[model samples]
Target: MKSHWREYIHCDPKILIGKPVVKGTRLSVEFLLGLFAEGWTEDQVLENYPTLTLEGLRAVFAFASECISQEVWYAASMVNQTQ
Candidate 1:
């Protein structure tokens, strides 16, 4: 079954100023994405941050994909308009 991002991700004003984060943890989606961008593998992340699970990692990607898709749609809509 496809993992739902909402199952593992959360955002609260009390947490990182409402940045989307892994539920029950303070790890932000942006921070996790940055780890991968910096060449950290799944094993590296899991080993270093035992609190994070494989599913939580997947949720982070899912959340980011959703955000990018929305951004892409908005950008496409403005493609023909003057900046």
Candidate 2:
């Protein structure tokens, strides 16, 4: 089955400088992640952003996980090297 994140999150150039956002809302994924970093609970987030659903929250996490998993890292010294 398709991941819930794929269904719930999207990026549009016209929205928040193309940041990934919850579908049908202007809430950016970065903002959502920040809330969690600030110690906001799932219930608190739901209460504050009434437009967001539990599944949407899960999607945000999933999207972040997917992004991190696919990221490639290089040492700072490698910046000057050519392929």
Candidate 3:
């Protein structure tokens, strides 16, 4: 997935309390991702949410990938052992 998510996703304080959502829709990226986590296929999602496009779905994943890539993580044991 590329950075194309920028074209399909937007954040607005007025929308879902600033949660990132699909452009022009109340569909939050978190919500879409949750559907997938709950075992929803791309086809199922599209069928249920008629307004969502294939590109939009792909964007959700790309956005998530970018977010995770920019974060930092450490093992709890590593911190405790250091102390």
Candidate 4:
């Protein structure tokens, strides 16, 4: 398991408005995360989406983690000052 989202996921302006998706599939990372949020198990996800692999699922999480980790949260006061 490389644990690298880039290895399994990609974004294209031609696909889903440039949202990240598993390679070779139209499924978006947000959609998959929503499925898990709605109580869909890994097995169930795999069963429903045969094109998705365990590695791809892991990549989704990895991509999300990277995105969250890189996010910058601005303070309300700072935002107000900038306005």
Identify the leading candidate in terms of lDDT: 3
- Per-candidate TM-scores read 0.82, 0.82, 0.87, 0.82
lDDT of 3 by residue, 1-68 (tens): 56688999999999999999999789999999999999999999999999989999899999999998
In what order do the candidates fall by lDDT, top score first?
A: 3, 4, 2, 1
What C-alpha lDDT do the candidate models reach, one value each? 0.89, 0.90, 0.93, 0.92
Candidate 2, 9-78: lDDT as tens digits: 9999999999999998899999999999999999999999999988888999999998987999788779
The C-alpha local distance difference test score for the whole of candidate 3 amounts to: 0.93
What's the lDDT of the predicted structure labeled candidate 4? Answer: 0.92
Q: List the residue pairs that clash in candidate 4.
A: none
The list of candidate 2 runs beyond 4 A from truth reads 73-83
Q: What ranges in model 4 sit over 4 Å off?
A: 1-3, 73-83
Residue-level lDDT tens digits of model 4 in 1-83: 33567999999999999999999899999999999999999999999999999999999999999888789989899999999
Point out the higher-scoring one by lDDT: 3 or 4.
3
